[model samples]
Target: MQIVNKAVVFESGHEEYAVPIQSVISIEKVNFINPIPHMPLYMRGVTKAREDLIPVIDFESVLYNRSLAGEEARLLVVQTESLQIGLLVKDAKEIIDIPQEALKQMGIAAYEKTKYFIGVAAFSDRLITIIDPDILVSSLEGIKDIQEYMKQNKLFPA
Candidate 1:
Protein backbone atom coordinates (compact mmCIF):
# COMPACT_ATOMS: atom_id res chain seq x y z
CA MET A 1 0.00 0.00 0.00
CA GLN A 2 1.18 3.51 -0.85
CA ILE A 3 0.77 6.51 1.37
CA VAL A 4 -1.17 9.43 0.00
CA ASN A 5 -1.23 13.14 0.84
CA LYS A 6 -4.17 15.42 0.44
CA ALA A 7 -3.79 18.91 -0.93
CA VAL A 8 -5.96 21.94 -1.31
CA VAL A 9 -5.55 22.97 -4.90
CA PHE A 10 -5.89 26.59 -5.94
CA GLU A 11 -5.31 28.74 -8.97
CA SER A 12 -3.17 31.86 -8.95
CA GLY A 13 -3.36 33.62 -12.26
CA HIS A 14 -2.77 30.99 -14.92
CA GLU A 15 -0.79 28.68 -12.69
CA GLU A 16 -1.99 26.05 -10.28
CA TYR A 17 -0.58 25.49 -6.83
CA ALA A 18 -1.35 23.17 -3.98
CA VAL A 19 -0.78 23.20 -0.25
CA PRO A 20 -0.99 20.30 2.13
CA ILE A 21 -4.59 20.21 3.30
CA GLN A 22 -3.46 19.69 6.87
CA SER A 23 -2.01 23.19 6.96
CA VAL A 24 -5.18 24.86 5.73
CA ILE A 25 -7.66 26.04 8.35
CA SER A 26 -10.43 27.44 6.16
CA ILE A 27 -11.34 29.03 2.87
CA GLU A 28 -13.17 32.32 2.59
CA LYS A 29 -14.25 34.66 -0.12
CA VAL A 30 -12.25 37.83 -0.58
CA ASN A 31 -13.56 40.60 1.61
CA PHE A 32 -12.58 44.07 2.66
CA ILE A 33 -8.84 44.24 3.22
CA ASN A 34 -7.62 47.14 5.32
CA PRO A 35 -4.38 48.21 3.75
CA ILE A 36 -1.24 48.54 5.82
CA PRO A 37 1.25 51.26 5.09
CA HIS A 38 4.87 50.60 4.04
CA MET A 39 4.28 46.90 3.38
CA PRO A 40 5.32 45.04 0.30
CA LEU A 41 3.00 44.85 -2.71
CA TYR A 42 2.34 41.21 -2.05
CA MET A 43 0.99 41.94 1.41
CA ARG A 44 -2.58 42.87 0.46
CA GLY A 45 -3.65 43.80 3.98
CA VAL A 46 -5.34 42.35 7.02
CA THR A 47 -8.88 41.06 7.27
CA LYS A 48 -10.98 40.30 10.31
CA ALA A 49 -11.66 36.60 10.54
CA ARG A 50 -13.48 35.68 13.70
CA GLU A 51 -11.54 37.45 16.49
CA ASP A 52 -8.24 37.44 14.68
CA LEU A 53 -6.85 39.94 12.23
CA ILE A 54 -5.32 37.67 9.64
CA PRO A 55 -2.69 39.14 7.38
CA VAL A 56 -3.48 38.49 3.68
CA ILE A 57 -0.97 38.06 0.91
CA ASP A 58 -1.60 38.36 -2.79
CA PHE A 59 -0.36 34.96 -3.93
CA GLU A 60 -0.44 35.91 -7.60
CA SER A 61 1.79 38.89 -6.99
CA VAL A 62 4.17 36.83 -4.96
CA LEU A 63 4.40 33.97 -7.44
CA TYR A 64 3.78 35.48 -10.83
CA ASN A 65 4.67 39.14 -10.33
CA ARG A 66 1.13 40.00 -11.38
CA SER A 67 -1.74 41.52 -9.49
CA LEU A 68 -4.91 39.50 -9.08
CA ALA A 69 -7.48 41.31 -11.20
CA GLY A 70 -10.91 40.01 -10.38
CA GLU A 71 -13.66 40.05 -7.80
CA GLU A 72 -13.81 36.26 -7.63
CA ALA A 73 -10.62 35.83 -5.71
CA ARG A 74 -10.66 33.74 -2.53
CA LEU A 75 -8.57 33.43 0.60
CA LEU A 76 -7.02 30.22 1.84
CA VAL A 77 -6.33 30.61 5.55
CA VAL A 78 -3.27 28.61 6.46
CA GLN A 79 -1.48 28.14 9.75
CA THR A 80 2.21 27.74 10.29
CA GLU A 81 4.21 27.26 13.45
CA SER A 82 4.22 30.93 14.48
CA LEU A 83 1.50 32.58 12.46
CA GLN A 84 -1.82 32.24 10.63
CA ILE A 85 -2.17 34.11 7.36
CA GLY A 86 -4.50 34.24 4.39
CA LEU A 87 -3.20 33.43 0.94
CA LEU A 88 -5.15 35.08 -1.87
CA VAL A 89 -5.83 32.80 -4.77
CA LYS A 90 -7.77 33.44 -7.93
CA ASP A 91 -9.86 30.36 -7.35
CA ALA A 92 -10.11 27.47 -4.92
CA LYS A 93 -10.35 24.06 -6.50
CA GLU A 94 -11.20 20.67 -5.01
CA ILE A 95 -9.19 18.65 -2.56
CA ILE A 96 -7.35 15.73 -4.10
CA ASP A 97 -5.37 12.88 -2.68
CA ILE A 98 -2.00 12.51 -4.36
CA PRO A 99 0.22 9.52 -4.11
CA GLN A 100 3.57 10.23 -2.46
CA GLU A 101 5.29 8.97 -5.54
CA ALA A 102 3.61 11.69 -7.62
CA LEU A 103 5.56 14.48 -5.94
CA LYS A 104 8.92 15.13 -7.58
CA GLN A 105 11.35 16.98 -5.39
CA MET A 106 13.09 19.86 -7.04
CA GLY A 107 16.85 20.26 -7.06
CA ILE A 108 18.56 22.13 -4.25
CA ALA A 109 19.38 25.06 -6.51
CA ALA A 110 15.77 25.31 -7.61
CA TYR A 111 14.62 24.94 -4.04
CA GLU A 112 16.88 27.78 -2.95
CA LYS A 113 15.46 30.06 -5.63
CA THR A 114 11.84 29.14 -5.09
CA LYS A 115 11.69 28.58 -1.39
CA TYR A 116 7.92 28.61 -1.28
CA PHE A 117 7.55 25.70 -3.69
CA ILE A 118 8.25 22.26 -2.28
CA GLY A 119 7.89 20.43 -5.57
CA VAL A 120 5.64 19.79 -8.54
CA ALA A 121 2.92 17.19 -8.81
CA ALA A 122 1.75 15.86 -12.12
CA PHE A 123 -1.94 15.23 -12.10
CA SER A 124 -3.83 14.35 -15.25
CA ASP A 125 -2.90 16.91 -17.87
CA ARG A 126 -1.95 19.65 -15.46
CA LEU A 127 1.07 20.27 -13.29
CA ILE A 128 0.47 21.64 -9.83
CA THR A 129 3.26 23.29 -7.91
CA ILE A 130 3.20 22.23 -4.29
CA ILE A 131 3.60 25.16 -1.93
CA ASP A 132 5.03 24.95 1.55
CA PRO A 133 2.96 27.13 3.84
CA ASP A 134 5.83 27.64 6.26
CA ILE A 135 8.20 28.71 3.54
CA LEU A 136 5.55 30.80 1.82
CA VAL A 137 4.73 32.62 5.02
CA SER A 138 8.35 33.21 6.01
CA SER A 139 9.87 33.91 2.61
CA LEU A 140 7.79 36.93 1.74
CA GLU A 141 9.95 40.03 1.28
CA GLY A 142 9.82 42.43 4.24
CA ILE A 143 7.58 40.00 6.07
CA LYS A 144 9.61 40.11 9.27
CA ASP A 145 9.88 43.89 9.17
CA ILE A 146 6.17 44.28 8.58
CA GLN A 147 5.39 41.70 11.25
CA GLU A 148 7.45 43.73 13.71
CA TYR A 149 5.55 46.82 12.62
CA MET A 150 2.27 45.05 13.17
CA LYS A 151 3.41 44.00 16.61
CA GLN A 152 4.54 47.51 17.49
CA ASN A 153 1.29 49.02 16.33
CA LYS A 154 -0.72 46.58 18.38
CA LEU A 155 -2.23 45.11 15.25
CA PHE A 156 -0.99 41.70 16.29
CA PRO A 157 -0.11 40.34 19.70
CA ALA A 158 3.55 40.74 20.43
Candidate 2:
Protein backbone atom coordinates (compact mmCIF):
# COMPACT_ATOMS: atom_id res chain seq x y z
CA MET A 1 0.00 0.00 0.00
CA GLN A 2 1.18 3.49 -0.74
CA ILE A 3 1.77 5.49 2.38
CA VAL A 4 1.36 9.21 2.72
CA ASN A 5 4.54 10.87 3.88
CA LYS A 6 3.11 13.99 5.34
CA ALA A 7 2.53 14.48 9.01
CA VAL A 8 3.37 17.27 11.47
CA VAL A 9 5.70 15.59 13.94
CA PHE A 10 6.83 17.33 17.07
CA GLU A 11 8.81 16.63 20.20
CA SER A 12 7.49 17.17 23.67
CA GLY A 13 10.39 16.77 26.03
CA HIS A 14 11.76 13.39 24.92
CA GLU A 15 8.65 11.89 23.37
CA GLU A 16 7.39 12.45 19.85
CA TYR A 17 3.93 12.38 18.28
CA ALA A 18 2.62 13.04 14.80
CA VAL A 19 -0.58 14.64 13.58
CA PRO A 20 -1.82 14.52 10.01
CA ILE A 21 -0.19 17.43 8.20
CA GLN A 22 -3.41 18.21 6.42
CA SER A 23 -5.04 19.07 9.71
CA VAL A 24 -2.56 21.76 10.57
CA ILE A 25 -2.76 25.38 9.44
CA SER A 26 0.44 26.97 10.80
CA ILE A 27 2.98 26.67 13.53
CA GLU A 28 3.58 29.65 15.81
CA LYS A 29 5.50 30.71 18.88
CA VAL A 30 3.12 31.49 21.74
CA ASN A 31 3.43 33.25 25.05
CA PHE A 32 0.20 33.04 27.01
CA ILE A 33 -0.61 35.66 29.63
CA ASN A 34 -4.31 34.86 30.00
CA PRO A 35 -5.89 31.58 30.90
CA ILE A 36 -9.39 30.38 31.60
CA PRO A 37 -10.32 29.75 35.17
CA HIS A 38 -11.57 26.36 36.36
CA MET A 39 -10.12 24.63 33.35
CA PRO A 40 -7.94 21.56 33.38
CA LEU A 41 -4.33 22.11 34.35
CA TYR A 42 -3.22 20.55 31.08
CA MET A 43 -4.96 23.37 29.30
CA ARG A 44 -1.93 25.66 29.04
CA GLY A 45 -3.61 28.99 28.35
CA VAL A 46 -5.07 31.13 25.61
CA THR A 47 -3.70 33.67 23.16
CA LYS A 48 -4.97 35.92 20.43
CA ALA A 49 -4.65 34.75 16.85
CA ARG A 50 -6.02 36.88 14.08
CA GLU A 51 -9.38 37.99 15.53
CA ASP A 52 -9.87 34.87 17.61
CA LEU A 53 -8.43 33.90 20.93
CA ILE A 54 -7.29 30.32 20.62
CA PRO A 55 -7.17 27.81 23.40
CA VAL A 56 -3.78 26.18 23.89
CA ILE A 57 -2.99 22.87 25.50
CA ASP A 58 0.35 21.72 26.80
CA PHE A 59 1.01 18.61 24.77
CA GLU A 60 3.64 17.35 27.16
CA SER A 61 1.76 18.07 30.33
CA VAL A 62 -1.40 16.45 29.06
CA LEU A 63 0.30 13.34 27.78
CA TYR A 64 3.15 12.83 30.22
CA ASN A 65 2.04 14.91 33.17
CA ARG A 66 5.15 17.06 32.99
CA SER A 67 5.40 20.67 31.97
CA LEU A 68 7.98 21.56 29.37
CA ALA A 69 10.10 24.65 29.68
CA GLY A 70 8.77 27.24 27.28
CA GLU A 71 12.08 28.89 26.41
CA GLU A 72 12.35 27.14 23.03
CA ALA A 73 8.79 25.92 22.61
CA ARG A 74 6.45 26.29 19.66
CA LEU A 75 2.68 26.27 19.24
CA LEU A 76 1.36 23.83 16.68
CA VAL A 77 -1.79 25.13 15.06
CA VAL A 78 -4.24 22.30 14.57
CA GLN A 79 -7.60 22.79 12.90
CA THR A 80 -10.59 21.41 14.72
CA GLU A 81 -14.16 21.19 13.55
CA SER A 82 -14.99 24.33 15.46
CA LEU A 83 -11.80 26.36 15.89
CA GLN A 84 -8.06 26.38 15.47
CA ILE A 85 -6.09 25.37 18.54
CA GLY A 86 -2.44 25.71 19.37
CA LEU A 87 -0.79 22.66 20.89
CA LEU A 88 2.24 23.80 22.84
CA VAL A 89 5.26 21.58 22.47
CA LYS A 90 8.93 21.86 23.15
CA ASP A 91 9.99 21.53 19.51
CA ALA A 92 8.72 20.36 16.15
CA LYS A 93 10.30 17.52 14.20
CA GLU A 94 10.43 16.56 10.55
CA ILE A 95 7.46 15.23 8.63
CA ILE A 96 7.84 11.70 7.34
CA ASP A 97 5.92 9.01 5.50
CA ILE A 98 5.49 5.48 6.71
CA PRO A 99 3.53 2.53 5.45
CA GLN A 100 -0.11 2.37 6.46
CA GLU A 101 0.11 -1.24 7.58
CA ALA A 102 2.83 -0.32 10.01
CA LEU A 103 0.34 1.62 12.08
CA LYS A 104 -1.20 -0.20 15.03
CA GLN A 105 -4.31 1.10 16.66
CA MET A 106 -4.04 1.28 20.45
CA GLY A 107 -7.77 0.59 20.75
CA ILE A 108 -10.48 2.54 22.51
CA ALA A 109 -9.21 2.03 26.03
CA ALA A 110 -5.95 3.83 25.41
CA TYR A 111 -7.68 6.67 23.65
CA GLU A 112 -10.25 6.92 26.40
CA LYS A 113 -7.57 7.79 28.92
CA THR A 114 -5.29 9.99 26.87
CA LYS A 115 -7.86 11.41 24.49
CA TYR A 116 -4.98 12.58 22.36
CA PHE A 117 -3.48 9.50 20.77
CA ILE A 118 -5.85 8.16 18.19
CA GLY A 119 -3.58 5.26 17.40
CA VAL A 120 0.00 4.08 17.51
CA ALA A 121 1.78 3.97 14.19
CA ALA A 122 5.20 2.57 13.40
CA PHE A 123 7.89 4.45 11.53
CA SER A 124 10.64 2.09 10.46
CA ASP A 125 11.79 0.50 13.71
CA ARG A 126 10.39 3.21 15.96
CA LEU A 127 6.78 3.79 16.88
CA ILE A 128 5.23 7.22 16.61
CA THR A 129 1.98 7.97 18.31
CA ILE A 130 -0.52 9.23 15.77
CA ILE A 131 -2.77 11.95 17.00
CA ASP A 132 -6.27 12.58 15.74
CA PRO A 133 -6.97 16.29 15.95
CA ASP A 134 -10.68 15.68 15.96
CA ILE A 135 -10.46 13.57 19.07
CA LEU A 136 -8.33 16.18 20.78
CA VAL A 137 -10.79 18.89 19.98
CA SER A 138 -13.85 16.89 20.89
CA SER A 139 -12.42 15.92 24.22
CA LEU A 140 -12.02 19.49 25.33
CA GLU A 141 -14.92 20.63 27.51
CA GLY A 142 -17.15 23.44 26.24
CA ILE A 143 -15.69 23.38 22.74
CA LYS A 144 -19.03 22.52 21.17
CA ASP A 145 -19.44 26.00 19.75
CA ILE A 146 -15.90 27.35 19.69
CA GLN A 147 -16.79 30.83 18.53
CA GLU A 148 -19.68 31.25 20.93
CA TYR A 149 -17.75 29.69 23.79
CA MET A 150 -14.86 32.08 23.38
CA LYS A 151 -17.22 34.98 23.02
CA GLN A 152 -19.16 34.00 26.12
CA ASN A 153 -15.96 33.94 28.14
CA LYS A 154 -14.78 37.14 26.52
CA LEU A 155 -11.51 35.54 25.64
CA PHE A 156 -10.88 38.52 23.42
CA PRO A 157 -10.44 42.04 24.69
CA ALA A 158 -12.68 44.83 23.45
Candidate 3:
Protein backbone atom coordinates (compact mmCIF):
# COMPACT_ATOMS: atom_id res chain seq x y z
CA MET A 1 0.00 0.00 0.00
CA GLN A 2 1.18 3.51 -0.71
CA ILE A 3 0.03 7.06 -0.16
CA VAL A 4 -0.42 8.90 -3.40
CA ASN A 5 -1.15 12.43 -4.51
CA LYS A 6 -4.84 12.69 -5.26
CA ALA A 7 -6.40 15.24 -7.56
CA VAL A 8 -9.79 16.41 -8.64
CA VAL A 9 -10.23 16.18 -12.40
CA PHE A 10 -12.38 18.50 -14.44
CA GLU A 11 -13.12 19.09 -18.11
CA SER A 12 -12.29 22.27 -19.93
CA GLY A 13 -11.96 22.82 -23.66
CA HIS A 14 -12.71 19.18 -24.29
CA GLU A 15 -9.62 18.22 -22.34
CA GLU A 16 -9.01 17.19 -18.78
CA TYR A 17 -7.16 19.18 -16.15
CA ALA A 18 -6.59 18.57 -12.45
CA VAL A 19 -5.77 20.20 -9.17
CA PRO A 20 -4.72 18.68 -5.92
CA ILE A 21 -7.65 17.29 -3.96
CA GLN A 22 -6.26 18.90 -0.83
CA SER A 23 -6.72 22.30 -2.41
CA VAL A 24 -10.32 21.66 -3.30
CA ILE A 25 -12.87 23.22 -0.98
CA SER A 26 -16.14 22.12 -2.57
CA ILE A 27 -17.91 21.35 -5.80
CA GLU A 28 -21.07 23.35 -6.06
CA LYS A 29 -23.91 23.92 -8.46
CA VAL A 30 -23.37 26.94 -10.63
CA ASN A 31 -25.04 29.98 -9.16
CA PHE A 32 -25.90 33.30 -10.70
CA ILE A 33 -22.82 35.42 -11.41
CA ASN A 34 -23.00 39.11 -10.72
CA PRO A 35 -20.85 40.52 -13.48
CA ILE A 36 -18.49 43.42 -13.02
CA PRO A 37 -17.60 46.05 -15.55
CA HIS A 38 -14.06 46.35 -16.95
CA MET A 39 -13.01 42.95 -15.77
CA PRO A 40 -10.96 40.54 -17.87
CA LEU A 41 -12.67 38.24 -20.32
CA TYR A 42 -11.67 35.20 -18.37
CA MET A 43 -13.45 36.46 -15.29
CA ARG A 44 -17.14 35.65 -15.19
CA GLY A 45 -17.69 37.77 -12.09
CA VAL A 46 -18.55 36.79 -8.55
CA THR A 47 -20.79 34.07 -7.24
CA LYS A 48 -22.02 33.17 -3.80
CA ALA A 49 -21.46 29.69 -2.49
CA ARG A 50 -20.80 27.94 0.78
CA GLU A 51 -21.98 31.10 2.52
CA ASP A 52 -19.14 33.09 1.00
CA LEU A 53 -18.44 35.14 -2.09
CA ILE A 54 -15.82 34.05 -4.59
CA PRO A 55 -14.67 35.14 -8.00
CA VAL A 56 -15.49 32.77 -10.87
CA ILE A 57 -12.77 31.95 -13.34
CA ASP A 58 -14.06 31.17 -16.78
CA PHE A 59 -11.89 28.16 -17.44
CA GLU A 60 -12.96 27.88 -21.03
CA SER A 61 -12.22 31.49 -21.72
CA VAL A 62 -9.00 31.34 -19.84
CA LEU A 63 -7.68 28.12 -21.32
CA TYR A 64 -9.50 27.53 -24.56
CA ASN A 65 -10.61 30.96 -25.64
CA ARG A 66 -14.13 29.60 -25.68
CA SER A 67 -17.28 30.62 -23.91
CA LEU A 68 -18.48 28.51 -21.02
CA ALA A 69 -21.84 26.86 -21.15
CA GLY A 70 -23.04 28.28 -17.88
CA GLU A 71 -26.13 26.10 -17.79
CA GLU A 72 -24.05 22.95 -17.73
CA ALA A 73 -21.04 24.22 -15.80
CA ARG A 74 -19.90 23.33 -12.32
CA LEU A 75 -18.19 25.62 -9.88
CA LEU A 76 -15.05 24.00 -8.56
CA VAL A 77 -14.11 25.97 -5.49
CA VAL A 78 -10.44 25.80 -4.70
CA GLN A 79 -8.21 27.54 -2.18
CA THR A 80 -4.57 28.48 -2.32
CA GLU A 81 -2.43 29.64 0.59
CA SER A 82 -4.31 32.90 1.04
CA LEU A 83 -6.83 33.38 -1.75
CA GLN A 84 -9.98 31.45 -2.69
CA ILE A 85 -11.67 31.30 -6.06
CA GLY A 86 -14.00 29.22 -8.19
CA LEU A 87 -13.14 27.57 -11.49
CA LEU A 88 -16.07 27.33 -13.84
CA VAL A 89 -15.31 24.12 -15.62
CA LYS A 90 -17.29 22.32 -18.27
CA ASP A 91 -17.65 19.24 -16.12
CA ALA A 92 -16.22 17.77 -12.94
CA LYS A 93 -15.70 14.02 -13.07
CA GLU A 94 -13.79 12.39 -10.19
CA ILE A 95 -10.92 12.20 -7.81
CA ILE A 96 -8.00 9.91 -8.49
CA ASP A 97 -4.91 8.99 -6.58
CA ILE A 98 -1.85 9.37 -8.77
CA PRO A 99 1.32 7.46 -8.13
CA GLN A 100 4.50 9.47 -7.89
CA GLU A 101 5.91 7.58 -10.86
CA ALA A 102 3.00 8.66 -13.01
CA LEU A 103 3.78 12.37 -12.78
CA LYS A 104 6.03 13.92 -15.43
CA GLN A 105 7.67 17.31 -15.50
CA MET A 106 6.36 19.92 -17.92
CA GLY A 107 8.73 20.94 -20.69
CA ILE A 108 6.65 22.45 -23.42
CA ALA A 109 7.95 25.81 -24.50
CA ALA A 110 5.56 26.89 -27.24
CA TYR A 111 2.45 27.30 -25.12
CA GLU A 112 3.95 30.20 -23.16
CA LYS A 113 1.29 29.78 -20.46
CA THR A 114 2.54 26.74 -18.67
CA LYS A 115 3.34 28.58 -15.46
CA TYR A 116 0.46 26.93 -13.64
CA PHE A 117 1.01 23.48 -15.03
CA ILE A 118 2.93 21.28 -12.66
CA GLY A 119 3.03 18.29 -14.98
CA VAL A 120 1.08 15.66 -16.85
CA ALA A 121 -0.20 12.29 -15.71
CA ALA A 122 -1.01 9.62 -18.21
CA PHE A 123 -3.53 6.94 -17.48
CA SER A 124 -4.54 4.13 -19.81
CA ASP A 125 -7.31 5.97 -21.53
CA ARG A 126 -6.55 9.61 -20.87
CA LEU A 127 -3.80 12.09 -20.12
CA ILE A 128 -4.45 14.75 -17.51
CA THR A 129 -2.63 18.00 -17.03
CA ILE A 130 -2.11 18.80 -13.38
CA ILE A 131 -2.04 22.41 -12.33
CA ASP A 132 -1.21 24.35 -9.24
CA PRO A 133 -4.18 26.51 -8.36
CA ASP A 134 -1.97 29.14 -6.79
CA ILE A 135 0.13 29.51 -9.90
CA LEU A 136 -2.85 29.37 -12.18
CA VAL A 137 -4.64 32.17 -10.37
CA SER A 138 -1.52 34.25 -10.04
CA SER A 139 -0.65 33.79 -13.72
CA LEU A 140 -3.76 35.55 -14.91
CA GLU A 141 -3.19 39.06 -16.17
CA GLY A 142 -6.03 40.84 -14.38
CA ILE A 143 -6.41 38.52 -11.45
CA LYS A 144 -5.25 41.16 -9.00
CA ASP A 145 -7.81 43.62 -10.23
CA ILE A 146 -10.45 40.96 -10.01
CA GLN A 147 -9.45 40.15 -6.47
CA GLU A 148 -9.34 43.79 -5.52
CA TYR A 149 -12.83 44.40 -6.91
CA MET A 150 -14.16 41.46 -4.96
CA LYS A 151 -12.53 42.75 -1.81
CA GLN A 152 -13.63 46.36 -2.23
CA ASN A 153 -17.18 45.46 -3.16
CA LYS A 154 -17.80 43.45 -0.02
CA LEU A 155 -17.94 40.34 -2.14
CA PHE A 156 -14.88 38.66 -0.68
CA PRO A 157 -12.70 39.07 2.39
CA ALA A 158 -9.65 41.25 1.98
| Candidate 3 Cα RMSD (Å) | 2.8
lDDT of 1 by residue, 1-158 (tens): 21229999999877888889999999888878898887899988899776688888998888778878587788899998768888889888789888877887756425554777777788678888888888777777788977787788787787
Clashing residue pairs for model 2: 5-97
Candidate 2 residue-wise lDDT, 1-158, digit = tens = 11335788888767678888888877777766376676676776688655567888787877778876657788888887666788887777677775677667666625466666766667666777778787777776655544465768786432
As a whole number from 0 to 100, the lDDT of residue 156 in candidate 3 is: 69
lDDT of 2 at 50: 56
Total colliding residue pairs, candidate 3: 0
Tell me the lDDT of candidate 2. Answer: 0.72
Count backbone clashes in candidate 2.
1
Give the TM-score of each candidate: 0.90, 0.78, 0.92
| Selected candidate, larger TM-score, 2 vs 3 | 3
In terms of TM-score, which candidate is stronger, 1 or 2?
1
Error of 3 at 148 (Å): 1.4
